[model samples]
Target: MDFEDACDIAEDLQFDLSGEELIDAYRERADAMVPGEPGRAVFLGYLGEFLAMAGRPEETRCLRGGGA
Candidate 1:
């Protein structure tokens, strides 16, 4: 799905996500919907942005380390 469609879905979810978090969740859903697709990087980038926006950049970094 495109960014606009993702944004719409985020809005419908009513999660009170900031713009970055909304994009992040959308990317996560999109990536999950289509595994091994070329869009994974896009989703990852949005996830990083969301973490940073939420002041949880360390969590994001930790996730990249293959551990919880």
Candidate 2:
């Protein structure tokens, strides 16, 4: 998906993943996803959200590779 779409998903995740521990849990879940699967978007989306939650939005943007 696109950066904007990823950000939107991340924003939505803020409700359920409101704290650092929760966000880290989500990150671990995302990390467990297999590569080259349809879930990649979901993984990246969560990763982006985690970075943002962890005060690293720039890293999230960079991880997205472009179009942020």
Candidate 3:
């Protein structure tokens, strides 16, 4: 799916996920995107930034733990 679609999904699901799970879900979606696609890096970067802003350190830690 495209970045915008992913963002929409994230927004829709934000309330349903634990902060950590939300970040994990976004990271998974970002990773599944094809490399070199326009906005791929930006999408992932923004998700990471958002997670940090949301104080989701456990989520960020899991992402890092997965080596993404």
Best by TM-score: 3
RMSD of each: 5.0, 6.4, 4.6
What is candidate 1's lDDT per residue for 2-36, written digit by digit as tens? 65655555456446665655755655675585655
Q: List ranges where model 2 is wrong by over 4 Å.
A: 1-17, 65-68
Whole-model Cα lDDT per candidate?
Answer: 0.60, 0.64, 0.66
lDDT, residue 2, model 3 = 63
lDDT of 3 by residue, 1-68 (tens): 56676566767757777666766776776787787664455456657777778976666565556634
Estimate TM-scores for all models: 0.48, 0.48, 0.54
Q: Which TM-score value belongs to model 3? A: 0.54
Please list all clashing residue pairs in model 1, or write none if there are none.
none
Q: Which ten residues in a row have the lowest lDDT in candidate 2?
A: 1-10
- Lowest summed-lDDT stretch of 10 residues in model 3? 59-68
